[model samples]
Structures are given as structure tokens and as C-alpha cells.
Target: MEDMDAGRAGTARRWLDKLRGLIDPERMGDDFLYLLYHDALARRLGTCHDQRDNLYLRRFERPQIELFDLMAGHLPVLTLAGRIGGALLADHLAGRDTATLLSVGIGSGGQEAAVLTALAKRGRAPGRLTVIGVDPAVGSLHQAERAIRDTGVTLDFHHVPRFAERMTDQDWDLVRRAPRPLVMNAAFALHHLRDTASGADERNTFLSKLRDAEPDVVVLCEPDSDHHRVALPERFHNSWRHFHAVFRLIDVLDVSAADRNAMKLFFRREVVDIVGTADDEDRYERHEPAETWLARLREAGFRPMPAPAESVSEPMPPAFVRHDPDSVRIGFDGESILAVIHAVPAHA
Candidate 1:
């Protein structure tokens, strides 16, 4: 047993050293190096599981769910993004007698619930509100249903257990036939839509479908990194820079070390997908920069809308927010971590 342990430790050390050598010293600062060292050490020591699998499939597992909630509650990027998304959705829903919200990848309905709660507080909730949640994970759909119902708001809830890219016409008919004043929200989602060499164009195709649905407003919150490149070296450099900032934010949280470590562990699956998936068709965490999404939205015939004022007015400590003419972005240490974009149909 001692010999086996030693062998494993040696292998782990060698892997870490190889990873360190790949990263350019000028590209990664000392703090990032320290964070990477600890992350690699923890995974090797079995403090965090290293097995790779479909990240969405594990969405409802108790451990992953708990870690997700921990990060959502304490991590400044997630907390602020959720808040900003909810605010943006609420802004569109204000003063409507009836409205429909079609949320893609509505995992656990946390952001939707917050939007409903905010509307209720402001006495601006629609008399008849319908929520349609689309996600491939059945467990996540169930959880979202429960969470939205628990919001104590009387509204219609519908679930389409299908990937946004795989939604059948019947499923879209449900969305198309839903009540008017429709507002679409995709938060930290859409990145999972796979793009292949065959040029399936799943992401853009889905966006075009959304545009055809003629939603009054569409809100998209996504990471501002470009991990979608097929080249390993470029993808690795981007992933390292993006996640370095994320780990830094996690380090400053007031949570216990155990919880913090677990939260970081949750991201390991993402990192693995970004760097380990040699086949671009099989990779799921294909995050792109804000500019890419903006261009896609425009190509899909959607016009970008100005970001809400509140999104950029107050700067959270260690997290700064800026608004371009079209999108609001949140970042840490000079890296743009996340972006929230609002858009409407070109004719609207």
C-alpha cells in the first residue's frame, strides 16, 4: 500500500510539473500559480474527485447541488450576475398585465424565482404569468418546477425536458403559442450547445429560433472567456486566465475551507472539458467571449438593447462592472468574467 501511494503521488507531481511548464510565466502571475498548485494537489490527494463526465448530467446530485448553491450564494460573480439578470428580467416584466418567460437551462429555477420575487415585491408581477423552462436534465426541470412553485406566485409553469439545441417543433410550438409579452432568459446557459466541424451551427440556429419566436426581450448572461477554440494551447491559456480569476474570487469568500474547496472542485469538471476534450464535437463547456455572442445575436436578427443602469452603477469590492452600449460586464482583477446582454427583435 505504501509503494502504491508513493507511485500515485509521484505521478501526480509529474502531471503538475508538466502543466506548470505549459503555461507561460508571463501569462500567469504568482497568485495564479499558487492557486493552480493547490488545485492540482487537492485533486491528486482525492480531496476532490477527478473523474470526468457530462457536467449537466450531475446538476441535481446532492453534492454538486450543494457546492453550486454555495458558490451562487458567496461567489461575487455568480451572486452579482444572478442579481443583475433578475433585475433585467424584472425591468422588462414591469407594468405588464400578462407575460411569459421562457428560460433556457433553468437549472433549479434559482434566477427565475428571484425574478418572480422581485416583481412581487414591487407590485409589478403580471396578473397572469407563464414560465416555460427548457433543459435536458429531468431532475433539474423538476427542481425548477418546485422552486418556482415555492415562490408563492400564482402562475403557469411548463417544462420541456430537451436540450435547447434538440427542441422539437412541438416543443417550440409550446413556446410560440404561449402568452404574449414573452421575455427569454438564458443565464450561464447556451454555452453547452455543441458546435461541430460539420457546421451544425447549433448555437446560432437556436438563437435564430428564439428570434423567430418574437420574444419582447431576451436576456443572456454568460462567461466572458473564449474556451471554444479547438486548439489546445490557446484554449488552455484562456481557461487558465479565466479560472484563475474565478479561483481568486472563491478564495476570498467567507465560507469554510471545506465548502470553498468543494466549490472549487465543482469547477474541475469544466476545466477538464476545456482542456481534455480533444474532439471539439464532444466538448460541452464551449464558452465564448461577449463579442462573439453579440455578433451571433445580431446575425440572428436581434437588436441589442442598452444595459440596465443598476448593473453598472455600483461596483462591488474586488468586482467591477461596466456597460457598453449593449451589454453589462462584470469582472475581477482586470479580467471580464461575465457579461449580461439584453436584446429585442430587430423590428421590435
Candidate 2:
């Protein structure tokens, strides 16, 4: 067992070193050249992740969630943010008899499952837990709906097979039919709203619509990076910093070469989107830092709520603590990468 573990670690290290060598901005010098090199490495390494395909999600995204859950208790910061976010949501819904949870980008329903578990444990199980999941991918929604239903949580789940930004009256009508107060939960999904040159405009518009809908609280768990910027140079630099930290984290994990490579490909797609696309329509994986989200939430008529009493920062795993945590923010490598932000409608 010990020898096998060492072998896995060594293989992971080599993969990390290779990826680092390819991603070294100083060595690459030119952003365009770096993009070209990155693309070639992706092809050669067989790490290309296409989001449009169902097979990709089943083969990569679904199994990745299992890995995420396993790492959550050990040290993974991204999954840690999710635990904190779910706790906050549970606290918000504690005393309510019935509340709606609108999970945007409910990929495979992991976050929803986590939130449901939290609520059940709190003894605040709503009389009717109406879960409305909105996603552009119908296949993902079906998987999420099934995943949550299998959890045996008594709830009415409505899947809106459409993009959250493009939600129409039919979707809203479904949401309206749910018992209130409504809670909007977005996990790693809102960043995809950057389908236009003005991501801020699109973000604000979506938040405005949500605000008008009067959700009691909005829980946001997203990557705290600045890859949402339109400028390729800035995007490249910011992405390098964010992904450098991720690769460093993956290097230490005792996993198979194939698993590590799949993760590499999954994240590499983000690099491709940021550096490869000039047109907004071609981009789908835009991410912004926590501060950007805070600003947008405020502009869209939401105010930050206090972190729950149970919310406490843990000793970050070695080499991953990048920024200091005050009350609500957690950083990795001086960048606030994972955050569990709780905000309520300003008027409420």
C-alpha cells in the first residue's frame, strides 16, 4: 500500500510539473504564444473537456463531485466553501415552515443535496421543500433532479430547462407556484452569464430580475478569480495565478494518473475559454473574484448578511491559504478563490 501510494504521488507530481512547465507565464512570455502552447499541450495530453456533451459530464463532472465530497472533510477549500454556504442556507431557512430553493446551474445536484442534508439535520425540514433548478443543459437538470429525488427528501422539484439569464414567464410562473419565501442558490453557475461583452451588464440584469422576484436570500458559491475580464492579457495573468494554485493542490492528492489528468483537462478548458475566445458568444467559463460578485449583488439590490454563528474558518491545508479570512471570505494563494457569500434582498 505504501509503495503504491508513493507511486501515485510521484506520478501526480510529474503531471503537475509538466502542467506547471507549460503554464509558466514568464517562460512563455507572450500571451498569444502561451495560448498556442497551452492548446497544443491540451491536445497532446488528451485533456480537452467539452461542456456541450453529456458523456463529458457523466465521465468527468459526475465522478469529480464524488472526489470533491471525499476531499471535503480532508482539506479541499472549494468544497469547504460549499459546506459553509449550505450551513448559512440552513440557518436562513431554519424557522420557516416552507421555503423555495432555486439552484442555478444545479450540476448533478451536489449542492442541492448538501443543502437538503443540512436542512434535514437542523430539524427545520420545510413542509414542502420546493427545489427549482435552472440550467441550460437539459441533461444536467435531469441528472440533478434524479440525484436529489433519490435523496428521499420530501420536496417538489421543478426543473427549468433553460438558462437562468433567459428565464421566461413560464419559468417564473413555476417558481411563483412554489411556497415562499424564496431562496436563490447559485453554485459555480452564475459566471457563465458572461455571454456578452458587458458581463457586468448581463450579471446586473440577471440579479435585477432575481431581486424583482424577491428571493429572501441569495447564496453564491463561485470561483474567486478575475477571468471574467474581456482583456486577454489580464485574463491570462489572472487565470495563471488561479490555476497555479489549483494545480499545486492537485499535486499533493493521492489519486490515479487518469483522475488527475481528467481534472487537469476539466480545468484546462477554463484556460482555453479565457485565452482562446475573442467573441463573447464563444466564452462560457468566465469567473470573477468575490468582490465583483459583492458589487453586483449590491447594485442589483441585495445586501450581505452576517455569516452564520456556525461559520468558522478552518486551518487551510498547507500551500493553499492565499488570502486572510476575516468574517466571510476565504483565500488561496493571496487570491480569494472560494467564498460562501450570503446576501438578502436590500428592501427586505
Candidate 3:
């Protein structure tokens, strides 16, 4: 048993060294680096030697909604962002007689439900509310519908089961013709749109479309990491650093060890997508820095709104909130992990 443990440790050390080597600037053009990345991820996931020919081909249990609910209850970054975002949305909805909310990538509707609850508490909910949910996953849309219904806020709900980027002309028309004072909530979703290439201009097309919708307020929550434009080596380094912080945060969560491990494991797919997708077209988790997003929003004819007022008197330590001129950033240990931006038509 001792010898087996030593062998496993040695293999892990070798994998770590290989991963480090892949991030070296001098090794940028190495053709074999992609295979190394794949194998390294497979090894780390304990599937490199599995009977399945490919790591991805092997079936792994998907993280359940209960697990995510557990994480949301304990993860400061998530809880804070949700609260801050809900507050901002509720603020925007205040004093509106009729309003429509277009939620891009409205996964499971947890955030929207929270926003509705906040508005109800403030007694500022619109007299007639219309929520348009766009997402590619039918299951998520169903879950979102249920969640929205549970809020007990009478509203018209439209589910557009399509990727935000791939929404049909009719679908967009639905948004354009929705109730007045249209507000959009795109939380951790836009980064999935495929750009022409790393650091390319294709993203601008989508942003321009968003501007055309003429939303009264657009609330965006995105990671403050540069996984989009950089090449694989830099992407690998960035992902490693970013997820290391995330995993460490998870470690201190007051949850069962198994639950904590499951939460960490849920993020493994993101790391793999960041490093393993050799072709830029195939990569979906292309997170850009907050600065990039801000610039893009401006170029798309949206101006940032004032940062949301700090509501929490004492944020948990290690989780700091920074109000920048253009957006609100939530970070752990001084590293900005997520940014919440409120923007509107420059002319608005």
C-alpha cells in the first residue's frame, strides 16, 4: 500500500511539473502541448487510465441543483453577487408601472426569483411584469419558470429556448416589442458567445445587438479573468490561478467535506474547457477581464451607471467588494473574481 501511494504521488508531481512547463513563455509554439494538456487533465481527474478511450467519453455524474443551492448558501462570492445584483435590479424596477425583463441565460431562475422577492418586499414591483427568459437548455427554462411562479408575483413569462446569440429574429422582436422600460439581466452568460478568435471583434456584434434592444438598464455579472483573448499558455496560467483561489475559497466553506469536494469538482469542467479546447471556435468559456467588457459596452453605445450603494455593513473577510468608477467588483484576497456592471443606452 505504501509503495502504491508513493507511485500515485510521484505521478501527480510529474503531472504538476508538466502543467507548469506548458505555461512557460518559451514553450508557446510546442505542438505537443495540447496533448499534454489533455492527458494532464485526464490524469488529474483520475481518468487517464480508465477503460473509456477518452476522458470526456466517460460518464460522470453532473452536479445537482441541490449541490449548487448548497454552494450558493455558503459561497460568499455567489451570495454577495446575487444579493447585489438583485438589489440593483429591484432598484431599477422601482416606480415603474409596467416593465419587461429579458434574462439572458436565465439558468434555473434563482437570481430572478430573488430579485422579484426583493421588489415585493419593497412594494415597488411593477403593476404588470413581463419576464422573457432566453436560454439554450430547455430543462433550465422549465426550472426557471417554476422558480418564477413560486415568487407569487403575477407576471407574463415567455420562455425562448435558444442560445442568446442564436436567438431568431422573431425572438428578438419579442424582446423589442415587450413592455416598456425593458431591463436585461445577463449574469455570467455572455462569455459563452463564440468570438471570431481570441481577442477578436465578433463579440462586438452581439453587444451591438444588445444596444439595439435599447434596454433601460443592463445588469451584467461576469468573471474578472482573461480566459478569452490570451493564448493557451496564458489561459492555462490564468485558469490555474483563478480556480486555485476558487478551490481555496471552497475549502473554507462550512459544508461537509464531500459537499465541498463536489462543489470544487463542478468547476473542473470549466478548467478543462479553458485549456483543452484547442480550437477557438470550440471554446465556450471565454471570459474576458472586466476592463475589456467595460470597453466593449461603451463601444456598443452603453454608458455605465453609478455603482450600487454598499448595503452590507460588514462583508465577510477575504471577500472584499470594490466599487469602481464603471462597475462593482467582488473579489477574494484582492483578486477581482467577478464584476457586476449596470449600463444603459448612452442617450438614456
Candidate 4:
């Protein structure tokens, strides 16, 4: 009886934790109350329901960032961008027998795998490949390592556990010493460098360093929303525009109701974090539009490398399924939600 009671008590505790996680104190009496309230009501009505457990903590918990794609049918824009960028770099460096790749915010290294796979398909897979991955999350680093290893490519990976802003000289030296014609992919990672104040200089400085490094090519994939604005009201409006479109996309997805609800709730946290947090909070989410990235790259002396005309006309797979297309298009689910940029230094 005692052992059985103990097990029951532990289960009850877990249940309590899950319930508590579902209720946000910030939304208890605000305009956002209706949002979570509707979710609660939906659960009670035996309709589609999201997981009650804390999902924000699981953002990068998996080895791959495909959960959002699985639940919401979001096309893998970054991976497609990576493939195109890789092909561009491979063609640019045709004389080189080996190539090195440096990825910022490599999150599970899925994008890098796509880049390598693209190179392989084109008979441009480097004789030897090296990847220098930088991310603040050690868990994410491990996941990236595992994902890269699964590809069975001749790629050497070195992970640096530091945010891009805090990277030391030694960290950069590793990238600089690698073989010439180094290529970089920074997929959905640059927005977090924003702060409460203007990040114009910081953004420029970050890109300037990359410019000085003189990598043959750098690929950047970022959200198309204007969530990086310092003002809360404007940020909320852009986020609303972005997420509302996302919700609509989720609603029509072929996924189950439970999956649909889970995706809604998962994205809700992003809206809350972007709106609720002060500018000084380091953990706040900040996303910027594609034009901002284009200007930044231009300021950093990078010139756009357009996809080949033939590749541009190639057909893309229907939504939800995973496939690499050469064209670097940003829209997803009939909405343009992200930007994929392939560029090289002005003088390179």
C-alpha cells in the first residue's frame, strides 16, 4: 500500500506541474487572458488540445528543429537556402579540392547537412570538409554533432560554446586558419543579437568581422517579421501579423487536432516573450524583416549572389514534405515568413 501510494503521489505532482505550466501569471487578467482561456475551454470540450507541459524549455531539446515543421507544416526555408548557398560557394571555389564551413547558430546542424547534401548531389562534395559551429547552448551543440555525424559525410565539426557577441579571438582564429574559400551559414540566428537600444552598430560590427574574415560566401536565413524593433507596440503588431498568418497556416495543415493545438500553444509563448519582456532582458525574442538583413549585408561589403537562371526556374516540392530546391525563396504556406540570402564579399 505504501509503495503504491508513493507512485500515485509522484504522478499527482507531475500532473500539478503540467497544469501550472499551462497558466501564465502574465495573462491572468490582461488582454491575453482570452487566448489561454480559449485553449483551456477547448481542452474541457474534448476538442483539439495542446500539451499542458512546458514547451518553451523544449525549443531546442530535440536533435532537429523539425517539430515546428511536423506540427505546423512550415517549409524548411533555412535548409533550402543552405543548399543553394552551398552550391553557389562550391561553384565559386571550383579550383579548391577541399572546403571548410563555419556556421553560426547551427541548431542541430540540419542546415549544414542540407548544404553538404546539395554539394554531393552536384558532384561538388569537397574532398575533405570541416565545420566550425558556434552556439551558446551546449545541449544544442551535442544535438548538432549527432545530426552531422548521422550524414556519414567526411566532415569534421568543432563546436564553440559562446554566443556570437562573446566569441573570443581564439574562436575566430579557428575559422580564419581553415582552408581558403571558407563558407558560412547563419540560419535564423542573427536576430537574437538585438537589445533594448539600437543594435545598428552591433549588427554592423558582427557583419564587419565576417567581412574582414573574407569568407568566400555567407548565407543568412532570417524571419520576415519586424519583431526586432525596440518598441513594444510596433513589435506586437508585427508579431501579430506574423503569428496570425502562422495560425491560419496551422489550421489547414493535415496534422491531427492535438498536433495543431500543440503548435498553437508552442508559438503563443513566442508572442508573449516578444511582447512581455523588457528590452534589457537577454532572453527576449527578436526577429527582423528580410530588408533589414539585406541592408546589413550591403553595409558589411557583401554583394548578393543570385541563383542561376536555370535553378531559379526549377520546381519546388509541395508544402510539408522535405526536399531541397535551388531557388532561394522565403515564403512558406502561401505567406512570405522568412528570407534566405546568399552573398559574397564585395572584393572576393
Model 3 lDDT per residue over 1-348, tens place: 122134465665566546544553123322123333444455544544424223422232345776677768788988888877877888777768889989999988988888887777778767778999999999999999899888777789998998877788888888889998999999999998875535556668878887888889999999989998786667877876777667667766677755665566567567768865545577789999889999999999999886657644458666888888899888787778889998989998
TM-score of each: 0.82, 0.75, 0.82, 0.71
List model 1 lDDT by residue over 172-278, tens digit each.
Answer: 88889998889999998899887656868889999988887888899999999998754655776788888888888777767775565566667767775676443
Assess candidate 4 and give its lDDT. 0.62
Global lDDT of each candidate: 0.76, 0.66, 0.75, 0.62
Question: Candidate 1, after superposition: displacement of residue 208 in Å?
Answer: 1.0
Can you give the lDDT of residue 71 in candidate 1? 77
Better of 2 and 3 by lDDT: 3
TM-score of 1: 0.82
Off by over 4 Å in 1: 1-62, 312-314
Candidate 2 stretches with Cα past 4 Å from truth are 1-37, 40-75, 195-200, 254-262, 278-280, 313-316, 319-327
Candidate 4 residue-wise lDDT, 1-348, digit = tens: 122124454554445345556666344422233354334323323344445323433432332345555642443343445445555655654435777878898777766665556656666667777878899999988888887666656767898998887778888888888886698878778887854254455677778888878898887777778876546546656776777665665566566655555555666556656654433354446787777787888888998766664433343433221122322555446666666677888875
RMSD of candidate 3 to the truth, in angstroms, is 8.0
Residue 57 deviation, candidate 3, in Å? 16
TM-score of 3: 0.82
Q: Write the per-residue lDDT of candidate 2 for residues 1-348, one digit (tens) a residue.
A: 122124454554456346445543323323223433346333333445323222432444436565555455443676567767777777666667778888888877877776666666767666667889898888888888887776657778887888778889878777766688898888778888864554446788888888877888888888878877546556767877777666556556677644554554456556766655545467788888887888888888898776754554565464343322322565555555576678887876
Clashes of each: 0, 3, 0, 0
Residue 11, model 3: Cα distance from true site in angstroms? 14
